[model samples]
Target chain A: MPAIIELRDVTKTYKLGDETLNAVDGISLSIQTGDFVAITGASGSGKTTLANIIGGLDRPTGGSVMVDGNDLSKLRDRKLSDYRNQHIGFVFQSFNLQGTQTALENVTLPLVFARVKSKARKQRATECLQAVGLGDRLKHKPSQLSGGQRQRVAIARALAVKPNIIIADEPTGNLDSQHGDEIIKLLRDLNKQGITLIIITHDMNIARQAGRIVQVRDGKVRA
Target chain B: MRLVDYISLALRNITRRKLRSALTIFAIVIGATSVTIMLTIVFSAKGFINDQFEQNGTFQQVQVSPQTDINWGNGSGQNCNSSDCVKLTQALINKLAKLPHVIGIARQTQPYNFDGLFYGSKKLKLNQVVAYDANGIIDNHMLAGRDITQSDGNGVLTITSDYADGLGFKNNYQALIGKTVKLHTQGYYSGVGSDPVGRQQYMQTHCQNMGPGQNCELPSVQITGKVVGIADANGLTNSSGYTVRVPLSWARGMEENQDYGPARTSGDYCRNMPGPCMPPNVLTVTDELALNGYSSLIVKVDNATNAAAVAQNIRGTFKIGAADAETAIKQQLSVFNIVGIILGGLGGIALIVAAVGVINTMVMSILERTREIGVMRAVGARRSAISRLFTFEASLLGMAGGILGVLIGYGLTLIGNPILNHQLKGNNIGSSNILSLPIWLVITVIAGTTVIGMLAGLYPARKAAKLDPVEALHYE
Candidate 1:
């Protein structure tokens, strides 16, 4: 199988009061199509930064990143935003569902940016919510929903545009162990259906469940 | 993203903070309503004045005077000697009549012999007694009966409504028509309709008893005429409030200077006659109309557009003062234009302050929605989309305020017009609804406010668009 994403010596740096920190440094990685990969590290060990660069949310400061044969480092903001809309879905640890919007509306956000027809966007959003076992709570707002249900709504939003790759950064950080296990099972189910997945976390138990695991420490990959 | 989506989202955001949005819109309402009222008044006043002149056909007529300098509406020149003033004589009128573009002419004169007009027991002081050729060049707004015509001979005249009202016919001016009115002249008057034989007998009987150089005044003369029309007393078309209009033929007779004495041929006959023979009485009249000429001449051009050129031609050819209404109208309208600007500037100040309020509100809105903006960006909203959403919101505020203001202004006009109409009706003006809001003014005000709001939103929208997505996502 061909590699869907490739990175050769990618680096990202930040300056804090004249002190330079390498958030991501000298990383070369590849993920095949239809693969579930996990990246695990300690807090502030650059795992999330690596995931962000791969998802086209942030550009590498140096070197190159290629996703599906397009150079992510060379793309402008308009094209990068289009790439994210069409190809990548991000799930945050805090769920990041708009508190004021209904579950269906929250799930329809990405498809709206994709410029889908309103009727079709609504229909697809309902289907996405149902796939994450949230069909009954389509009209419920985030404040009305439990923690597990809120995370399910976020996952449903990530699946709205039928993205080819899903990047979840600490997706279960705020959930109990049982709810967290349920969310991991849902992600694995999506992965089993041929969507490439990348999970970023500090949990050894969640990392051990992926098909492949990469350990990150001090902006470097451990052997 | 689609434009509809941007609008929907913007509307939603505005509804999120209803109190703030309402306050911002209230500020804009003050500005828009003031602007609407000022513009409507200025433009409507200009339209009303222009309509009055247009109805009278004043724009198509040129006034010629003896003096070199003359303003419109003051047709006659001040008294000047023959060396310095060009008299509006018959020969000059004939020549001016033949000038190119000259369609018609009306010779105008004012006879000051009459002091009062009497109807029954009521006597009203006359402001002026005017006579002009009954041509179509000059028009009078008549409230009752008919204007003086070319066939109207002596004893036929028209009185303004004020004269009729003073004659106990206030609301019923038509009753004054066909009623004979007496024009009482000043003492020592010897104009038309005077009794020369009675004056001669009185002087012979009365003067013998008077001391040398003592004053011997003649009795006042009374001329009678049947009222032909009742003119509106609104001072329109250059007519005075208490004016009385008569035929030019009657005025010609009234303006004559009459002399009465013994005939020259009778002197030989009387000397050859026996004792106690009487000298024959004879009268000699001086034609004052020919000597002094008419007071002014009104020349009607072929078209209103040709009025100015014809006036220029008359001024150059005859060296007399000639003026068209266009020049005076422009000068008068420019005053209105300046007033409009000052009033509009005051309204503009209000709008500017409203724009500041819009800016402050938008900046605050962007701050409150920072996390939402970050989430939108992550969901693939372009930076341009965010900017457009806020701009749409601001312009919507302006549009709503402008619409509401115009509606309120329209309501005010509805309430104001009837009162104004009553006042005009009392003055005998025929037209009403002089206050109006033209379609262009309405469109201009709404579009202007919307553009102002869009400009005010630019800076804050840019600030929102330049927000860093990653940092904004974590913003509390």
Candidate 2:
């Protein structure tokens, strides 16, 4: 099958005073739709930078980044926001739920940004929360929820947008091993449901669960 | 995003930070309250001044007199002398009286020389003794006792209550009737081309004009007349003294003796005699006759509808400056407007300070929610949308503060007027207090405050919007 995310000689550079650091250099890769891929690397190995480029969160310094046949490199800031809203859902290491909002409202944030009707947003958010096994914790705030539960709520928010891809950057970095395994299993179940999944991680066990694993050394993908 | 959604979001944010929001709103309230109170005081003072003017018959009445010597030295040479004062003569008064819309015609003559009065144990001085014809129009409402009539013009005189009070009368109206008063005239003469000391010697030489009197040369002429009426005391009336309603005939002959040439030629001659001395200078077909050469004309219009037409006709005829009540009101309102703007501007500084508080609070919120913004941006929220959300929050804060300020301001005025009135008891202050706030003023204040609030949020909102998703996500 054709790939849903493709990177062609993607290069990302960071200027630090008088020196330049290449975060991701000459990375060429593709992942098919419904594929569960993990980009694994140690600290400062460009794994998160590669994930950002694939998720359309950051533009590569030099090279083409195509997601679902759409060129992300050519999209402006506004169009990129629209593209992300429609095609990408993000999960973060810290389970970045809006602390002021309840779990249900956090899930509804993406739909609210989409200008969805209030009633429909509520209905969709509720269904997504239920899918993540957080149906009973809808009214709980992020501070009230456990670290693992907050990650679940974040997952539900990502799914509520119904995007084609879920891009998680160290999705279990803040949780214990048991909670991390549960989060990985939930992501795997979502991938089985035909949604493409991409994870950036440092843990070898987490990388083993992915259908395909790409290893990065320095700024380049390892052979 | 829709306005309703923005409002909801903003309201939610405000409710989340209740204490900070309340403090910001309280600042606006204080600013608005000061503006309101100051405006009320300005309005009340203007109303009070206008009321006093109206009581003095100045609202509809104008004073026409020659520019004084002081004005001439000030480079303002506008004066009504013998040549110009002739425009408002007896002929004009008679002509105006014949007009269909003409209400009343009264001629006034100002005293040229003031003569001091010496009676039993008390000495009274006269500054302005206006002699009006007994047949002329008089405001009966101002009469404390009986007004001067045609029969009393022979020798009787009407004094103001202030003058009567000065004469040691317990009841001005009752005690002053049939009482006789004396007049003492003082004359000073200095020969031309004399030195200062020589002028002083000449003055002393002219001081001996007294006949069979004490060595001090006090010329006393006891002209006794019954006090037919006592008039109301306008507060401006000096305790110096005043006598009204003597016959113009006696006053004209008296002007010759006093060498008051201007008073003799102005109206004292024709008003005293029942005959014509010279041809009329200016002719008017309306009862309301204004003097062209004088500073102003005091006209009493029987029909207010004819006022505009008469004023227009006079302006065309005289070719000088003319103003009515409406013009005067507009002038007063312009002054009030300037004062209001200055006060509003000072109050605006306080609102600006409150707006800075809003920006600070919003910036803190943005900093605290950096990761959340990253999450939102990752999920496809646009930068413009995020900026609009923040701006909406600020606008809501301003609008809320504006509403609360208005309520507090209006409430303060409602409660403060009575207390002010109580403090003014026994004074000449008017019975009613005027603190009027038009609806347009309220709307402008609220809208202005909201705009100021929104402006304060703009830079912070832009900063929050420009934050990079990657950088925000990486933030600890």
Candidate 3:
């Protein structure tokens, strides 16, 4: 199948008062449709920055990022936001769920911004939560859930809009081996269902589970 | 996002910090209440002044005062055309009667003495002895009997209930109707007019060596008039609740006799004597021989708007000074309005402090929700959506305050009306409720408060919108 995400020499810079810092520099890569790709790197190797750029949460200072033939660099702020809502999903290490909200409410938040009608949004969010094995915990707030359950809720939230690309940054960083394995397994199952998956991580074992691994060092993809 | 979603989200956030929001809203309520109360006072005061002017005949009448040659407290100041004063003389009274728009031309009497009218042995000491043209004065205050009509002469008069009661007609106060009260225009002296000895003595005691301009007091002609009406109101002597109105013709004729009586200039008194000053020629006065002048002229016009034009015409043609009743009423009303504005301005300051509270709360809310805003933006909310959220929240706060304040204001009016009217009764002001808040006022206050809320939220909303979403996501 054709590549779903393509990066050509994408770069990201940071201003430090006077000196400039390149967070992600001269990076080029591509992933085919439905592929499970792991972006492997040590600390300061720019894997997180690359994940952010792909998620449309951060803009690269240079080069083009094309997802399904739509160049993200050419999109305006409004269109870029729509691109994130329609094409990409993000799961962070912290499992960014609103602590005051129910699991179902947390799942439906993305859809709320997507302006979906209430009845349809609730149905879609409930289905997503059930897919992540938390259907019965729909009314349970994040504080009432275990760490693994909370991570599942967050994963449910990411999948609510049914985007084509899922970007997970250190998805299992805070989990124990058993919980981490469950989350990775769930992600792989989702990838198997024909959704392209990209995981940013330092773990060799987690990277080995993906169909392809792109290793990074000093802000560039290793040859 | 749908408007409902925005509102729901705002509600959730506001409800989360319940105490803070309530306190902020309370500040707004206090501010709104003060403004509401003050404006209501202005509105009511304006109404009261207008009512007072209306009752005083300021709406349809213009007062024309002849420029007093001596000019002490006379109106028209430098604007008074002295030559125009001559045209307002009694001769023009009939001429002015012909002006098509001139509804009525009446002149008040040089006040009749309170002791002049006698009911048998008792002196009629009702309110002021008031007399004016047509039946206008007593027409407004008739309790019994009937007003003195144009055909009524010096032989007819109106008395107040207090005067009727004084004559021991308490059980049948209307009994005074058709009763004749002996009228004496001046003090009584034993045999002054008919006895030569008494006349000589009276002239020596009262008229000897009078000043250059001061005329000798005339021997008043006594003409008894029938009691025609009982006045319900006595504005002049409110303390005694007494008044007596007579026909304007009768009063003017009497005033003319008093002012230019005994038919004499100084030369006619001392120079043209036949023998020993001919015992002062006890001048035989005739109505045609008397000089006719008026203290002031009351001109009723077709309508209030025409009063100014009539006054202007009178001023342009005559030396008499004129005052536009409509203009005077409006001037008096404006004074109260300015006072009310000052009061409202003070209340506005309180509202401003309340607005500050709203601003503080909104800023704090924006700070607390930085991360939530980031999440919304990430999920596809436009920057404008985030700003709109805070503005809507602030406006909600203002709306709550405004509604509560207006309710409180209305409650105060309900409670204050009787108390204020009671206080005003002692001062003789009309007992109308003095706190009117019309629909426009209510709408203005609500819209004003909401606009204030929007303004207070503006800075914080802008700050929230301008926040870097990526950085905001990492905020704790």
Candidate 4:
């Protein structure tokens, strides 16, 4: 089967005043369609940088990353953001739901940028929240919601555009054991429904459940 | 994004910081209110000049007189001695007719004092007899009968209806038409240099040398003219004078027959009478009209616009004291325009301050919403859309402020008018309302303020638009 994401010697660098550091150095990886892939690394081992490169949030300094048949390095800022809007959903480690907006409004943000009508945005956002088990908390603001529910709202937001890939960058990092397991299971259930799910985490236990685990150490992927 | 969505989002943002938005809008309201009020006063002042001339129907003609010591203001009236006065001569009149834009030039005969009005031997000895070209008398108020046209009776003269009533005519004075009162005249040149009372006495002196209805040695010329029309009893002339008008040819004929010499002592010579003159007031008459030229010339132009140019030309050409109503209007309006611009600019300073306030508020709002803008950019929203959002927010503030300002301005005018008018009337200024805002001006002020507000937002909106999404997301 053809791979959904392809990375060929991808390298991301950083300037630390005088020294140059490669955050994602010479990474070459491929993940097939409908596969659950876990990128496991220590805090500074560059898993998040690799996720950013694949998610089109940041550009690689060298080599090309092909995602769903589009060259990620060649896209302009607008085209890159549009590609993320149409095909990739990002779930931040801290659950970046807008605190001022209601749960439903937070979920509706992607669809808003998608140029969806208000009525349709509302209908789809409501359904997405129900899918994430936060249907009853639609009108509640992030401040009013529990930590678990806020993460659920973030997940609902990621699902609002019906993107082809779900990229969860340490999705359960801020949650306790019970909330973390529940969020992981929800992500597992979404992947079982045939969406490609990539989890960027250092937790060995979470990586064990993925169909494949790519271990990142010293900015390189090891089999 | 759709326009409605932009407005919706802006509205929500505005309500989030209620006090700041209100304060910003309030500043603009004060600025726009003053601007609108100043414009109103300026427009009203221009209306005053038109109103003044319209009431008298004298807006179409320019008054030209030979350059002299007197300028025709309302009070400094015909104080010049007409007998010794240099006239706007027929030669000059012919020359004036050839001037561009001059439709026609009219001249008035110098007034002849009343000696006797003989209605079949019934005479009313009275004040001076006045004569002018009929067309020149268009502004006069006609009380009865038709105005004297060149096609009228051989010699037609109009008098005040009040004067006609005293002449044994109908109470209405319309019945005075066709009544022949033989006008008896002699050269009353001596009286022309003196006061009215002295002139009255000089005019009654009969020229004995000339037989009845024949020529007097003082060149007494009599003409029996039918009373054509009666004018109102108001001040006869614009400045004040003649109650009668005659054709130019008749006045010219009268001018030719009189003595053109200077004033003389009464007992100089009586060719037909013996020894010292028997009559007390009788004197040798001198013809003033022939000595000088015509006292004034009325130049009719194409319209009010051309009237000013013609008056300027006449002032330049004949070097005379001349005024067209249109020139006066333009002068008055330009003064109003200057005053209006100054006052409007003074008021506009408030708007500039408000604009700065808008910029400050927009910058603060963008800072507060930096993270939100970043999130939007990370999604599908473009840089232009982010800028548009902030600009729309600022413009919304201005539009609301403009609407409120227009209301406040209109309300102030409504309440201020009667109060201002009372003070104006007390101060002897005109009673017209000073705050009369036209509809187009009101619309323009509101629209213009909104544009200004949008322009004020440009810098802050650009700052917001250029913010890096990755960096903005990391901000606390």
Candidate 5:
């Protein structure tokens, strides 16, 4: 199968006052379709920065980031948005579900921005929430649901757009061990269904569940 | 995304903060209402003034007086010979009448009193003594009685129904036509040796002064004439305050003989008695004679199509000055416009304050929805789209406010009319209380409010649009 995401010497730099720091320095990596890859590192290990670059939320300072055959490094702001919408989805550490919207509405938000018709967007959002084991919580707001349920809603939102890749940054950071395990299993099942997944984490045990593990320290990837 | 989706989203967001939204909408409503009501008042005032001008006569009418100085107290100050004054003259009248667009010409003389009707010791005041040669042009549709004619110039008196009623006569025109009445003449009885109080001391000093049987002066011969016609007075009154109409010839005779009252000029009376005080050519039109002087001359155009051209021609012919009705109306309208602008400006200030409130609320909303914004950006919303959503929300608030304002304004106008009518009734001034709102003004207000609302959204919308998705998502 073809590599759905390719990173070639992708260097992301951050300005720290007068000096520049390399968050993702000259990292070359690839993940094939249906692969579950884990990028594990301590704090300041550039794992989250790499995830941001791969997800098309941030541009690389140098070199290329190609996902689904489009170079994200060269994409303009508008094209980057389009790329993210069609090819990559994000699940944040805080389970960034809009508290004001119901679980179904939160999931449907992506499709709404994509200009999907109301009925189709609602139907697809409902299906995605159900698939995430949130079938009974579709009408409940994020504040009304548990942390695990909110995380599930966020995952459902990311999957609702039917993107090829899911990029999660510490997806289970705030959940209890049991809920965290459930979220990990959800990602593993999605990967088993042929969707590529990339997760950034500091937990060695969580990283061990992935098919491939890449360790990073001081902005460099180690085998 | 589609407009419907955007609107729905905006509406939902507004609904989420219902109190904030309602407050913003309320501000807009007050602003719009004040603007509409102020404009309506200005419009009504302008209409009322124009109506008054029209009722008086056309604005084109101008009265010219040769330079002289006299204080008639609310009267003309022109002094010229009667002939020179009359030189506004048949020739001038005919020339003006024959002008291409001139419609009609008529002349008027001051009021005169003929005879007194004494009904058992009470004397009622008469109304008018108007004399017009072309009575048809003078508007003779009286509430009662017929108009005087050329024959009535010979001592005939036309009494109004009120006058007849006052005199104990049957309040019918025909019944009072040939009825006899006593005549009384009052004037300064000054002669070569006549005393000032001869009339008052008549019984006491009559025998001593007249050497038995010869009266000092035959109590100024009181002449009685049959009421040949009971005519419509057209609101003109004789000196006694009775609504009266006499023939033009009779009026002229009264003018020449000093029969009306005191002679306006001692020189005029002296000039007629064989030794002229001044040159005959230097005839003086006294302030009293000029009391009936027209302040302006109204020249009506024959063809409405030719109104402008005729007005221009008259201006050129008179070489004095000219003002067309349209120009006059525009001048009147400009006052309203100025008043409207001032009021609109005041309303604009209010809207600005409301806009600031809108901006603050939107900014606060953006702060609250940081993560949501980031989520939208991640989902494919461009910065511009985010900005557009917020801006759209702001505009909707303004529109809601504007609509409510218009309603409130109309309601105010509805309530104001009765109050205005009641006040005017107390003063006996006739007026209509309906508020006049032109279609263009309504459209302007709506468009203006929308634009203001949109402008108010711009800054906040830009701030919302420029937010970085990654940073925003990290915001707590």
Candidate 6:
């Protein structure tokens, strides 16, 4: 299959006092369409930064990031945000759901930014929740849900826009072993349905389940 | 995003912090209400005064005073015997009549010798007894009967409603019309209608017995006249506050000074005869009206626009004071304007303080919603959209306050008008509901508050829009 995302010598630096740290170092990688890839690293090893650059959430200091034929490095904020909305969905490990809103409302957030009508947004959010086995939990707020259920709700929110790629940054870091396995199974099922999935994790068991594993250390990647 | 979505979202945000939004709006309401009420009063009073002048035809008439520095609406003209004092005489009136835009002239005078007016023993102090040419140049708001016309001669007059009230007529002014009223002169009065023969006999009998430089008391004369009209005391533009008007003919007669004097033939006869011969007594009449000229002349112009020009012409040609009411009205209205500015400025200060409240509230809201803004931006909301949303929310606060304030102001007018009307009626003024709020005022107040809100929102909205999404999303 053709490559859906390509990065060439990507670098992201942060200034801390007088010391410049390269959070994302000069590294090149490619991921194909419908590919299930896992990026494994120790803490502070820049795996999350790589995921963010791929999702268009943060810009690299020097790099050409090509996603589905669009050069993200050259895009302005408006187009970059549009790329994130239309093509990429992010799932945080903390299940970053609005504690004040219902699961369905949280899912509708992306669709609202996409300018979907309210009725259609609701319908699509319901379908996404149902796909995540959370159809009956649509009206439940994050505080009312279990940790596993809240993660599933976050996944449903990420799935609402029907994006081309899903970036899961330590998707199961906060869950117990059983809940963590359920979340990984849900993401693997979604990957099987032809959505390219990238999981950032330190767990070797989760990384071994992916079709490909890229282990990152000291801001460099080794496949 | 659609405008509806933006508004809905903004409304939801505002509702989230209901107490803060309401408090902010309350401050604006106070400012708007004060501005509304103050401006309404000033504008309405200005409108009322203009309406009064328009009804009286004062705008079309130019008053010519003998004094060079005379102002319109003042009846005190120059009554000097000096040659420098320009007398408003018949010759000047004729020359003024020939001036461009001159339509007609009404000579005005006040008889100063009257002490009281008697209606069936109910004596009332005469404040002013005025006479003017019944040439339709002067208008009176008659309560009953008709104004003194050109045909009205001696013994015909019009008394104001205050006189009627003192005469026990009060609201029944019609009953006083056509009734005989006596005007009593002062003790030393020797004007028209005095008994010169009686005065001479009294002097002959009393003066001989009194020592030199001793004074002899003269009985006051009572002149009778029929009330032709009862006018509103506060309705006359030139003469207000308890006035009584009489025909010019009667005033001419009243102003005559009658005196007892020796006949012209007696002087020669007494010179040729023995020393014991007495001079024949005769009565002489002096025309004081002709001697003093009319106090002031009201020259009517063909149009109100030409009144100023005619006044200028009269001032230039006759060297007398000719003032159009427009100038004086403008001068008077400027006082209202000054008062309006002062009052409106007070309201503006309140609004500015309220705007500060809005800014504080918005800045606080932005701080609280920083994470939400980041989430929205990540989901694809443009920076402009976020900025617009916050601005809309602020404007909504302003709009709500403006509407509420205007309603409260309208309610106050409703409550205030009746009391004002009662006071005006007590003062004999006929106008009512002088606290009107025009549509433009309502619109301006609302729009002004909305604009103020938008301005106050700009800073906070810009701050919100410029926040970094990555940093904000992880904000604690």
List of clashing residue pairs for candidate 4: B132-B245, B216-B219
Model 1 C-alpha lDDT per residue in residues B31-78, reported as the tens digit of each score: 888899889989898888776667578899998888767877666543
Q: What is candidate 3's lDDT per residue for B276-313, written digit by digit as tens?
A: 65333353423311243555667788888788888777
| TM values, all candidates | 0.76, 0.66, 0.73, 0.69, 0.70, 0.79
Q: What are the per-residue Cα lDDT tens digits for candidate 6 across A1-223?
A: 9999999999999999999999889979999999999999999999988888898888889989999999998999889888888988888887778777899999998888798999999999999999999999888999999999999998988898999899998999999999999999999999999999999999999999999999888888975
Where does candidate 3 clash, by residue pair? B81-B319, B83-B319, B84-B318, B84-B319, B84-B320, B85-B319, B85-B320, B127-B242
RMSD of each: 6.9, 12.2, 8.0, 10.5, 9.8, 5.7
Q: Write the per-residue lDDT of candidate 2 for residues A1-223, one digit (tens) a residue.
A: 8888888999999999999999998999989999999999889999999988888899899999988778999999888998888888889898878888999999988887788888999999999999999999999999999899999999999998799999988999999999999999999999999999999998989999899899998889898
- TM per candidate, chain B: 0.71, 0.50, 0.63, 0.56, 0.55, 0.77
Write model 6 residue lDDT over B1-476, tens digit each, in one string: 77878888888888888899999999999999989998898889888878767767888999888887776767445344467777777877788888888889989988788989997868888767899988788888888999999998888999888778888998799988889999989756677778888888877887768887887777788989999899887677677556778888888888887888677678687888876988878888888878878888889999999988888988888888888888877877888888888879988998999999999999999998888887777767777878998999989888888999999999999999999988976665656799999999999999999999989999999999888877777777
Top candidate, metric TM-score: 6
DockQ winner among the candidates?
5
lDDT (CA) per prediction: 0.86, 0.69, 0.75, 0.75, 0.70, 0.87
Which runs in model 6 stand beyond 4 Å of their true positions?
A133-146, A176-178, B34-42, B66-71, B74-101, B110-131, B139-147, B154-246, B251-295, B302-306, B309-321, B344-353, B415-428
lDDT score, candidate 4, position A207: 95
* Alpha-carbon runs more than 4 Å astray in model 1: B64-104, B108-131, B139-147, B154-297, B301-322, B415-430
Each candidate's DockQ score against the native complex? 0.52, 0.52, 0.44, 0.32, 0.55, 0.49
Clashing pairs in 1: none
Query: Clashing pairs in model 2?
Result: A85-B380, B62-B298, B248-B272, B249-B272
DockQ measured for candidate 6? 0.49
CA shift of B333, model 4, Å: 2.8
- Candidate 2 C-alpha error for residue B109, in Å: 14
True contacts kept of each: 0.54, 0.80, 0.52, 0.32, 0.71, 0.52
Candidate 4 lDDT for residue B282? 32
2 against 3, candidate with superior TM-score: 3
